[model samples]
Structure formats: C-alpha cells, structure tokens
Target: MSDSLTLIEEMLGREARLFAASNVESDDRSHRTYIVADFEYQYHRSAHAGYQVAEGAAAEEKIRWPFHRIVAAAWTVLRFVPGQAVPEIEAPVVLTAETMDEKTMVTQFFDALAAMPQAIFATWGGEAKDLAALRRAAVEHDLCLPVQLLDLSPYSIRRLDLCNASSVMAASVHLPEYAAALAIPSKPSPRKEIGQLVENRQWDLVADQVAADVLTTCVIAIGHLKSMAVVTCDRPATIMALAEKAAETFPKSIFCSRSFRPWARDRLRAAGLRGTVFRAP
Candidate 1:
C-alpha cells in the first residue's frame, strides 16, 4: 500500500479489529457504522451524441442520468460506538484520478464499498441519484456490484437515504439547505463547473467537491440520527464542535492533497477556526 493508504488503515485499525470481533459474536453493546457516500460525475458526450445521431430531432441527452459518468467518488466512515461522546468520524477518503477512466474509477469505488457491505450506506440524494447512477455505470461497464447497494429499500437496515427518509424537513430540502440548517460548512465549487474541471483534468478540485459532499452528508446523517434517537451521542453543541473538527481535519489536511485548502480554509477562517489540525500517526 502507499504510505497514505497505510496511514488511513492505521487510522481505522482499532475499529477494523472491533468490526471483525462484532461479526463472530455480538458484544451485546450498541454500535453502528455508516459509510457516507457521494460522487461527482460528468455528462458523457458520447452517450449524448449517440442519442442525437440515432434519433436526430428526438435525441435529448442534455439532462439524463444514464449519460452521467462517475469522475470522483468520496466517502467517510463514522463509527458510532458506545462510551463515546459522539460518533468517531474517520478521515474523509476520496477515489479519483485525472487519468482514470470511468470504468476503473467506478470499479474501485464499488470495490471499497463491497469490502464493507453490512455497514449502513447513507447519503443525501443517494437513492435517487448517486446509487442509481452507479447501477447504470456498472451495467455499462459490466462491473460486479455489491448486492447491498443494488436493491436497497429506503427503510432497509443496510441503507438510508437522508434525502427521502424524513417527511418534510429532509426530503423536501436540498443537501446544501439541510447542511446549512445544521450549520455545517459545505460550500464548494458549483456543480456546473464539474464538467469543465473534468475537461481540464482538474481531478483534485472534483475530488475536493465530492469529499465536501461526503462530509456534509455525514454530518447531516449524524444530526438526523440524533433527532430520530437511532444513535446516541453528545449534545448538539458538542456534536457541532466535533463536526467542525472533522471539517478542519479533512477536505484539506496534512496527509493528503491541499488543493482544497485555499477554498476550504477561507471558509474556516471566516467561521473563526484557527491553528493546525492534529492527526495521530
């Protein structure tokens, strides 16, 4: 493994072992794991063109889900263990490369998720957009998908669509709006710019945007869980503090790319965050 990946593994080491133990026998303690996922995709011109050429005037690929190709997929692990003030948020992880094709990128993204199928996969627009797009991409590439993701019901134990889970406050609002309600820092480059970034091979920016989405989804999930009493944790004030800590720690950090720092740090400073973020070796 690369040094960076090794570090991430180390960061997750204790939870990794505990997860193994939980499988063999229930510890009789309350614990849960969530993989907050999000991704950035570019509209596939080829698919658009194929529709245009085949149907002439009838072709309209300007806005279609199947034509969207995954460019960056990002996630962060949240370990909701007892005896902790709040869920332990893992360092945000992103899968993307400027040179990687959609096939390889989607493959790696699913491979990572397949490694932890039982973990609850949470997202803002996950059901309607992210996973749907993934399913289409897998078909296009003949890639094997984890059954955990393919047929997940919203109420299924394996998946939760924050976007649609709630009655009004959640399903009716957008991801950014929900995040703003929770006071989380979620602003990144506009979604419209993703295509140009891909065209310019600006994978870092795309990755950052996806990572920010993942983080926002995670924090919002925590907030939602707290409201539902599904997971117990610290008070609202304390949880918000830890969420900010995660914002500072990830997106732009000591161990990974800083391409996100200039944009993210300014928001941090505006929010009055100072000092370097400490990560254990």
Candidate 2:
C-alpha cells in the first residue's frame, strides 16, 4: 500500500482502539444518538455586490455577510444507548465538494444525519452560524433540510449549541478557547486559514481541518456532558483558580464545571479512579 493509505489505516486503527477501550457500560436505555459537527463556509461576495447594485449604490450595505455556500462539513456520530457508560463513536465523516457542486455536498451531509435514528445534532456555534448558513444554503439551492435540522423550537433538546449554552450560564463561549481552558487539544488548523485553502481550491486540506474541528468538538461535548465536575464557590476567582488547577493537574481526568465540565466517566476509568470520586455539588 502507498504510504498515504497506510497512514490513513493507522489513524483509523488508533481511533478504533480509543473507542474500544472507553469505559462503555451496557446499560444504555435512552435509545438516542448524538452527532457532534462543525461546518466551514465562504461568504457570497458576489451576492453582496449585486444587492449593493440593486439598491442604487446608496443603500446601507448589510454588514451581516451571508454564508450562502457550504464549502466543507465534518461530523462524528455517537450512538448512546441509555444506561451505557460509553456511546459508540463512529469514524469521522467529512464532505468537501468542488465549487460548482458545493450545495450537493451540503445536502448529502444533512441527508446522512437525517437518515440516522433518533439523532441529536450538537455544535459549539452552530445556532448562530453553521445551522443558519446551512438553512439558507438549502433554500437557495432548493434542497430540503432534514427535519432534525429544521426544528426551531427554543426548548428542543434535539439540537444543542454549546456556545449558546455557555452563554446562558455566563461562561466562556468560544470553542477553541473553552477547549483550551478544559485541556482539550487545540484545533489542527486555524479558522481563518480555511478561507485561504478554499480560495486555492484545496478541498482535501479543508476537509482535513474540518474533520479535526469536528473531532475536537465531539471530545469536548463528551467531556462536558459526561465528565465535568460541578464545584461551588462563593468567589469567581476561586472557581477560576480551581478550574485552572484541575486542567493542569489532570489533563485527561479532571475537568471543572465552572469552565465547563472537564472530567468524563471514561476519563475517570482511564485514570483508574472510582466514579464516586466526583461528588455532586
């Protein structure tokens, strides 16, 4: 096999082992699945220019740049059976199409998610950016959005925006910053860099970066939902100090709820600690 193929196989193997060794219990009764995803898109500069022209060159230009096309998307789906300690983590899925067929890529990505059973889609800033852009793109392209993505109820748990959630709790909301604060590894590529790759028509590299973002988001969600510790303190400074210390002392095991939960049950198991070690606040 070519070296590139070998490397891909090795990476897949490593991810498989990581999932297999997770502290997965067989008691899952919720019968729900989770999809953690991220999307990368480019602005429609021409559309903006057209709007400016149509308004006779004097109308106030809309500052909100519409992401009318989806350049790339990546997601990781986890099947959570109620009562199970660890959900089944699927391999990362990435989609990046040629410029002419970008909408088709978006459709296919959503279609895959729609086909899944009882899935909940989660993203860090998806509500403000990714999902909104996707809905608009789907309409512009005359493609139908999956029901899972179309539901807009404020209380719906089917779609989760971690950034929004953090904002509600008045905590740090940026994904990369939050991940860093929680000791999750940084993204493989910077967000600004993806635009340059898109400009250069490097879809493969863009896909790779998006995949890394998706995986990082998935890990963060897992840590947030399953392993984060809730510590109560009278002073905000004390909370910050505790969070920093936990992240530094137990990069993989302990996570603070103040910055967002850092410790997952799997992390505790990996650290050879009992679940009871984390006391409820």
Candidate 3:
C-alpha cells in the first residue's frame, strides 16, 4: 500500500479505538458494513459519431451528442456497529484505466463494486447520473451489472443516493457545494475540470481527484447519519414546519432553502419514518 493509504488506515483505526473507548456501552455490539462510492466519467463527442449518424442526423448534429465513459471509480467501506454514534472509516479503494480504455475501466469499476456484497453502497447523485450512466455503459460494453445495483426498487437500501436524499430534504444537491456548506474539506482536483485532465492524459491527477471525491462522499454520509440521529421531531409535518420557519427567518441561508429538505429527510429516516417521499402541506 502507498504511504498515504497506510496513513489513512492508521487514522481510521485510531478513530475507531477512540470511539470504542468513549462509547463503552456499545463494546459488545455487532455491526454491519456499508460502502460509499463515487465515479468520474469523461464524455467525448467522437465516441457517439456512428450512433448519431445511424439515426439519420446530419454530421453537424452528430457532433452535438457525447458519450460518457467511466474513467475512474473510488469507494470506501464503513463499519456500522449497532449503538455506535458513527460508522468506522476504512481506507478508500480506487480504480483507473492505465491505457485509457473505456471498456477496461468500466469493467474494473463494476467488478470492484460487485466484490462488496451485502454492503449498502452510497453515492452522491449516483442514481440519476453515476449508476444510470454505468448501467448504460455496462450494456454497451456487454458487461453484467451487479445484482444489488440492478434491482429496480423504490426502497432499495442496497444503494443509497445521497443526492436524492438531499433533494428529498430540499437541500443543495450539488456534491461539492453541499460538502462546502457542511464545512467539509475541498477536493484536491475540482470535479468540473476532471474531464479536461483526462483528455490531457493526466491519469495521476484524475486518480487524486477520484480519491478525494470518494473520501469526501464518505465524510458527508457520516455527517448525514450523525445529524439524523440527533433530530427530535414528531412527524414530517413538524419537520416541514420548522423548515418553513427557518426559511422565513433566513431567506439567504441554505437552511432556509430546498437544501434543508434532504437534511430533514435524513433525520426522519433515522427516526424510523419512511422518508423516500416528501409530501408538501
């Protein structure tokens, strides 16, 4: 392992030990593990030229359509011991294509995710973008998606999309912006510029960005869980009332906007209420 990875593992271990020591009541509790993941893709107009032309479109129109190709993927598993305040962190895992081949990169990405079975996989905007793109890419590449991700269910706990949760709670759904709002550290490489780096063959930079994104995702998820555990409310109606009051009190604040919805949903879910749908009064 790289020195950085080793150091991260040490840090996680230290945190785990400290948590155990502080929460002695949970010493004998059993825990489940969940994986937090993020993926970065490069979109190129050249890859879809043939498909575009086949649809009877002019050459100029064909250039407008781009194909999204998975270039990097990163994930980390968290140990969720029952009665613990937060999950135990683990060193992140990253996958990238050495040759910049989409098929190889996509295959490896899915394979890594598939390796972790029975573990909840979480991501930011994964359902609408990351996983959706992956599903399409896997089909194009003739690759089989993991069963956990392929299951089409409204309440599939196997994969949690933090972005969707944020949307449900009416919070800012943008990953970097949301992370910033939560005071999480910034990524080494900005996600917006990653595609340019990929085009320039800066694999190292891409890997660094992916690593940072995945770690940030894990941190955000932990924060979400922690926040949910501390909420005291009777029903979604009460939470919505409080949200409206906050909005009226602080019009320019994120807490007063749609961004508050996801946070509210997270708390509601933690309170054993079904938070998948948000009903407005």
User: TM-scores across all candidates?
Assistant: 0.72, 0.66, 0.62
Off by over 4 Å in 1: 1-29, 152-154, 167-171, 235-281
TM-score of 3: 0.62
Residue 87 lDDT (model 1):
74
What is the lDDT, from 0 to 100, of the residue 190 in candidate 3?
A: 64
Tens digit of lDDT per residue, candidate 2, span 1-281? 69999778756754553344231212333455678888777767787777778987685565353735677877767665454445555655667766546677777777776565246788887877777787778778877666556567743556777777666757646677887776564455666677788878887677666765665576656555553331111222222233343344334321122222333333434456545555443
Report residue 205 deviation for candidate 2 (angstroms): 2.5
lDDT of 1: 0.68
The local distance difference test score of each candidate is: 0.68, 0.60, 0.61
Question: Residue-wise lDDT of candidate 3 within 158-205, one digit each (tens)?
Answer: 677777776685854678888777655446666678878888877777
Model 3: weakest 10-residue lDDT segment is 230-239
Summed backbone clashes in each candidate are 0, 14, 9
Candidate 2 ranges with C-alpha deviation above 4 Å: 1-29, 56-67, 169-172, 227-270, 273-281
Global lDDT for candidate 2?
0.60
